[model samples]
Target chain A: MVRMTSFIAGLSLLAVLLATGTPVQAQQYPPVGGRQFPLNQMSPPGTAAQWAINAGRVAPNYLQPVRVTLPQDGKVTFYESLERPVELAAPAQAALLVGRMYRLKVTGMEDFPGVEFFPSIELIDRLHPPQGREEDFPIDFEFTTEEFEWAANGRLITKVIYLEQPDRVPTELLERTPRITTIEPSRNVLAEADDLGRPMAIVRLGGRTPDPHRPEPSFFGPGGPIRLPAKVTQASAQQRPDAVNSR
Target chain B: MKYYFLALGTVVVVCVGCAMDGNQHLNKGEYHAPPAAMMGRPGPMVDGPGPGVLPMMGGMGGPGMGAPMGPGGMPFGAPPQRPAAPSTTQIRFVGPDGMQIGWLIPNGYAENQLVAPARYNFFQGGTYRLKINNIPGRDSLTLYPTLQVYPGHPNTEAYLTHNSVPLQLTEEDIEQVESNNFVTKVIYLPDARYQELAIANVETLVSTRLDPGVDPIQEADKRGTIMAVLRMGNMDLEMPGQTGKPMAGTEQGGIDQVAYSVDGAQNQFMPPLPIGPAGQGTPGIPGAMMVAGSGMPGAPISGVNMAAWGMPITGTPIGLNGPPHLPLGGPATLQSHTVRNRSKNEIPAGVKDMLIDVKHDPGYRLPPPVSYIQYTEKHPVYSPGELSMPAWAQGQQGQGQYCPPQQQQ
Candidate 1:
């Protein structure tokens, strides 16, 4: 009888301990500030390749005016198709589709004799200029002398061109020369540019050129469509600065 | 039966007491339950005050005293700690144009010659006195400043690796310094939410520009991660008989005696050290070693007597011995060995068809590929008089200009 009573007391003690034990809940820390969403989850404003693939998802046929400025005298040739090429003088303006990537063959650069550069321009976003006056404030794709030298020396240079926010513009009068800031390669250029101002375009310059005889088709990319500006009349052309210089 | 009843009653009373105590603890608001997002998620947990325990009583097994009991008698662990900052940080001196920036070395002041738009890596978490001189168009004017570079934080990992902190003295800053007033500049990269502009740019908070009662450092902290702080005053650090001149063989005013030159010929500039969570190794820094194959082999199992007895080596073939001339070890004697299976089995009497059945639990479905595309293009229609062909297109054989058919009015 004494042994049975002691055994019953031990059984009740075990039951009490089991009932008092609580479930082990895991602990969690708050998400890092400004990183509520993972980077890959963000849409549209991403890498050049991502922008190219998803450019027309919102507006299929939006064209942004882009002006190509060379360091020196050079001709920019745009390919319409496999064999169709349209050549234009430097400081040329064209209507490029937003989100599409285009390639340009730059030749006759007085600085780099006998050398040609095939640079790519990716237009991820567009400008909203006044109606029919888009040419006045086209996105300037100027290739600086330093950038040209860097590209010629086999270094890959990626430049992100952005429009300055009106309110955040510096109070002092800045020079017409665009403010160019080079960041580390590991950092996301798109993200950095997006923080300062609206990124308009991305220009990638490398030393890769196509072969003369057996030129690769993919080197020219998909040859996205482009609309050239209307030809200038002979009377107006004569009044132009370049026309006068030619004379 | 009576003993069993007595034990059951004891357990019932204890459980009832625990329940009442838990209810009272919840009513007193001593315990704050974790957020819904944090609940059940595994991470670093912060211990809270135990039930019926006060924070002041932490010494007596209370909160922050190692696994404090939570509301339901659950023990919560301590919170996670922040990682240590890197030893060195690179600071870029952007320009006010023609201004010279120099920092104090060990023994003396490394004076002017480090012009604006130069970059140098400095030891982090140290306050260094600086001399600013040679201001363009402002001769005979100089300002002494102190720069404090804080350690890196988790929030600044990406920003510090990819971007350099830009320090520039604007015209207003110079004017303020000339007025014999103290100026405090806080250089920081604002958080994404606090960033007003689309492009990320380094922002500076000037003490003179802000409201009188506002603290620039505090405001900058609320806005973004602060990289460095510069406090400038009109005080002349290089006064005659002062501790600015180079002291030979002796430490002057707690500064080291080493001299650093701006040209970096005497003492090379400290390269920027990679920091933050990236774990990127610097160009010249060594990192963890990587072995190529399966690593080195273990010691041989054969005994020493095997060499003296002329026994075949472990790697030798089972029946082959080493070269007859050499006793210890040489090339194996076995040359060629082959294995073949000659046994065959009879074919079954009748075996012809084979069938397989596969069923997907969730069937794969896809939209049919696009078959037809309709494109409509709009272009300006020119009249016959207005239509003109370019010189290059006019001479081509099939490129002659033809006017489009006129549309009905």
Candidate 2:
């Protein structure tokens, strides 16, 4: 009863039937190219946390993981859930803060110098509640010549910017400077290499400093530089009509 | 609880160690570290050797404070843990000129409450002074200058003092105080941070003197000022939109019309010294020159014939008032218009300062600048009758029922 669209946008609105999971929606926007940030997803433990409702088909919990093919090659595991709601700072503008959370997963792919996707990240849509613009939000991860390569797999090449959303657009996010924080093998790696032979899969970013956290989409209009208005926070995702069958 | 007391004991030891090593030097940085107001000490009397409890003298001949006085009335020694100059707490005020006037100190509020006498009116405004007093939560604040102009007559002899300067003429005297009566206010900060000694560090000792190693936290030190700006005026008097929240519900007190520059500038007036000998007194006449002269007003002659002090004085006392309400000379409704169409036009320096008489609108008038407003807050209160319902409710008056009118009836 539902449809799932890939990373490519349809020239005209087309609907396809899905096996079960994915919701049937209109045309989906392509993912924005993104880079890895060094920020941890959790709070300081004892503090109260704001949570996000599960609306997407994939669940990025300890039990299950989603796999997606990268533009370069090799497989990346997406923990389609994990990240909860948080109030992050919208860069540049000293006033506004973020209302949504990144739907993240520490993937099992040599994330660097490769196209690793940051999926399910929902930007508080001005009109729609909980529904996300499709493919998943993408992050362009690059590697310098000095960085070591995975002897088995070829090096990765990233599309740093989304060709569609330039600096002039309202929802177009800003470019993040290429600076790597930390990268290492995932705890549960399918294959492990010691002689610096295999590419390390999965890297976590964002520690004490800034730099890596996703930069806000810059709005240049009217009075010099204007930032996007606060995302009208919606309570919960709409319940799927065929809830029992969605699983 | 036992650990807490032990920690207190350790604090005692470190305090002793610190006393031996703490520097007493006051002028090391910006603030006046040494406490003034002379205090007393249990010392040997000036003329006593016989066993008479040893008569003592004061620190100005009264209570000795944390730092002792050195040669030529300066505080001696340096504090052991004076923070770097930049990290020190700074006391700032907005002068009549609207510029930030600041004096950085290596300390915080003396105790949470800052009380001091003004040698003069406060030149600076805004957050007046940061204090480091001993009070908690509500202390560590400044006593703001009560901006009042002298209301009484100048002819009274009781007005002058032994020093001859008006008593209110403390260091930061405001020129406006020459015109009003008394101005007063009290503002307290609900959150003020301070150093608290741990209960355990009561007895530990390092080198027999007060030591940080003994009580670590308790033995630790911090500094603050005893002075504060207690009075709070219109918070947004300087910045726009600052008064919105406070101005919404409760009506504010009236403030006289003293229009500052609309484009964000302030007016300032320096003082003519108090009427005394060094000021206007004459030589041969004993006190005549100093007392009779106008703070030597016209002494420094200028090229301008305008009273030598750059003030407007006419043949028949111009620019001053006759009695109350009757504005002197004209209604100030006069305006001048100069037609210019060019962009980035030159004002031609002094030509702009020159007054060019213009025709008035006659019936047209403008109102004074600043106005008063009301404010409200969410004051939580409880009601007894409503036991079954959720007690915490919101209301404008802070009390009453939340149920529908029909249901209550």
Candidate 3:
């Protein structure tokens, strides 16, 4: 019994030494301010290609849950709406393409269904026509089957990303770009129209009742400044030489 | 000057208040900060009011701390003593969620990577915080140094330092930092030796290199003077693959000419040059006309840039989708006016897709061919000779939307 206790104690001591001896990899670099990696979760499952992309092998990890890049942080929003479900079924079960560096979340769901997506690093290829913009390389995901039902009522499709995002370009092989993103509202509730003429997803619609508690709720109102009060302040003040003039 | 000092003094107090109390969460993704009371607990009366007044606790603007107020609302305190705002020095960690966050960065952590979102399920209700700050000190101190991080896969928890120079970390080391370059951490250890990786911003650098003799612009100018580059805003030339120098004495003056720079860090799709320099006066190639700049191909609003492209090569099948005569996954209809230069005389220069060298593609071992996108009166932007778009439905195409129909010879 005493020998057993001694062995156990020795093993415990060794374990503690190992734990304390080596500092965490995060220790090598400084802690990030305000930003946190959603590194805590096991990534969702998919094909070998998807796993390769998420595993930081073929590409950087793009399919972690709950990481947000904000508009204030050089982010842009590519939006589209579907009256129904959104389906990102690519050819040969390939990955769908999106346009933006986004931190996708289900902020507030209004009768929405499940969101299935594959954060394929393959889509992040720069050789494609629209290369540099991280925004233009949105990873494709699958949507719930009932997405078609929601298409009739104008579902919200929004992807907040970098302003310098790319557009719907060719498959990195040749030239030309489509102005509008295709949408099958039936497949994707927030999917935009496939006509290619409609670029931005439905951020707002005419005469839609908005949330009363929103700060500066004017999305497409007159002068269309999201923050009207800030606009008024700027308008009232004399423009300084260094004052920014953004729409 | 007087007002400035007063403002400075006021700022000092506020900055001190923020620095010392440790109440507000540090912007760097560190452990959640402790509560004010927890951070500054008042002890028993064994020492009779304790050391006359703790320096951090007695300062005005301190977090919920009680300081003796004086006449005119002055705290009558010594100049507020505050720890320096986190130096622009940084350490970065990419979390399991792929969110990049750090405590020290040129821009604070908020500007660098995404934060982990709140989770409602499987809440552990607990997380631990570790603070280790033994950095491998460099020869000189410079802020905002680029860190080439090497986050061990799966384990994801190892901090190390190796490059003697802060700017010499390998591309693989810096790969972890590509997405989240802003977040960093501040750690103070008993030992003074620091060993965390240092990364310098690619944009913050302007390393001198011999300009390659064969300028793409100069070559293209044979056809047309360099106009503008069609810089793609989406892609970037990250030189993470270029590491380790060739053997010494391999080039003139010991400079390795064989080295390749994953150049053009920004401006992805936009062309890199006009025809040649505008003075070269080389006419654009046939079928490649300088296009007018519009905006994102699909958006109604138009934006303009100086990237010059001949008429776009449109109406080709991008991928396989439907049968011949029908475009499957191709752009429904596009206008190519987004090209910066629109003058009919200006044949904007562009790289012909078939010939341009893949700068970073490791597999293809062939020298890049010099081909330009030319503007010809015939077959303007669209209308390819054969329906050769890769994945879409193949079919005879009418003239591209941006391309005007040509008159019959």
Candidate 4:
């Protein structure tokens, strides 16, 4: 029994010594080639790929969430509402191929059925006769339905992303951009069409009474200067330098 | 002679008038202040007080301490000395539930790696307060768990530092450690340390490297040293193969969706996107655009310089989703615009994926071809406990965790 106690006591002492003697940091190794590894989680399952797929599956025809970069000075009209499509310029535009596809990306609007992009006619590539048909060619926006839905409503799309494809575009005209064909909207929306020349239509429409709160109270009110008296010019210095002429 | 005498009398009269005018200046009085040395000090206290005198309370008959009585004989208590304002150095610590508070001197062989001061340890565990003078009230410090592995499969455990007891790995702590891996203790710091870490760039001096041969504990004792670093990590245990496919709503899954950064450390992403030649200049090879300006890609923000880490090959930051060019899974991968340019050698041998130089044209002048270096990690390349210090400390520095020399001495 005494021997057993002694043995246990020795073991306990050893454990304590090991714990207290070697500092917590002493055990820290250089971490090179150790089991110690940074455990980064994989891309979440319902993230980009899944969300894109879900959005694509529900809509009849939708713009893939491919992020499209407009060429330098490139501008595209994003149809925020079916009533009117507002045009927004690209981050920057410089190299614009006359007939290449410039992709645009949008997000969070699975409810938005489709959009109309109206690029300037000059931005569109028109192949001369002999090279191709004279008819304006519509730009092809590729939608990936592979295991990963690469393109979703909000994905960034790029111009010249599809230059290598031989089927939709001719190899000789890879540098050229596709012409934009205007798609008319459903007739019920627009009674008198504006100069855009396309038939007026509305895909989605709804309105709500605004909240009781005033539109975010802005500090930027139109104002003449408050005419605050900055300094009490000791009544002695009230006269201006021109006062000498008056005297 | 009579004219000169009359002139002198007239001058005297004029001088007298001038003196009287000076004396009649507005608000003038005969009030005279005593000399500077005798100015504000009160007269010595009288032991026996009479009328208008304060009665002696004990022997505290000092000039500043004595209070004179009013006509009503009301004696004012030494203008109730305002309680000394709480010291900014006083730090408060609120411990986890059911935590037993103990004092931690933070003294050990690993002292260099720790940021807490080594002079004293406090036992009150619920919350210990330290006065952080410069730190804002909102300054928060996140404590990440350090992991330890045992012999058994799936035997990895995580433990967080507390003032309770010097954390010792034993059978008793196993369960607590396992449960604590998910518990990322976010403690608010007195603003002093918070501002220090917040404004410090990635390469700010957090820890220093200890010499290989020297003993850390001995060195610490020789110099009373203290060091603080922003310890950061995800709250989920994501051991590669063990963490299957991160499904949404799962702890790991949620973390995966969001980009990771050192909890409080500011991350800066500046990728010097190659400037393209304007409108149909000679179509050069897509990837070989001339590097414009002496701009290096993805430099660290704040004052911490990262010049030591060779300038990384630059890629444009696409939105806020982090540097898109890196092929997933690196220290800088998910951080906004931060990526470590890996040398050709670091590309693991037999890296399965093809290196594709895909040009990212986000509707702007075309960006240089973004080379995506793809590889897969069935397991993490570095330990979860190990943090990737700033790029400046990248190479074979002080064993991953850099501990600066003990400055306490």
Cα lDDT computed for each candidate against the true fold = 0.56, 0.22, 0.24, 0.24
Summarize candidate 1's per-residue lDDT along B96-117 as a digit string, tens digits.
7778776665544566536776
- Per-residue lDDT for B148-222 in model 2, tens only? 122111111011100011121222222222233222221111101221221100011111233424532122211
Higher-ranked by DockQ: 1 or 3: 1
Over 4 Å off, model 3: A1-102, A106-108, A112-123, A126-142, A145-247, B1-409
- Distance from true position, residue A243, model 1, in Å? 49
Q: After superposition on all CA atoms, what RMSD does each candidate show versus the true structure? A: 24.7, 38.5, 37.4, 43.5
Residue B65 of candidate 4: its Cα lDDT? 13
What lDDT score goes with residue B243 in model 3? Answer: 36
lDDT of 4 by residue, B67-184 (tens): 3433332223332111111111111222222222121111101111112211122211122212111112212322233311111000000000101112212222223334452221
- Per-prediction TM-score, chain B alone: 0.43, 0.16, 0.14, 0.14
The DockQ of predicted model 3 stands at 0.01
User: Regarding TM-score, does 1 or 2 come out ahead?
Assistant: 1
Q: Which model is ahead, 3 or 4, in terms of DockQ?
A: 3
- Candidate 1 Cα misplacement greater than 4 A, ranges: A1-36, A39-247, B1-88, B243-409
Q: Of 2 and 4, which scores higher on TM-score?
A: 4
User: What would the DockQ be for model 4?
Assistant: 0.00
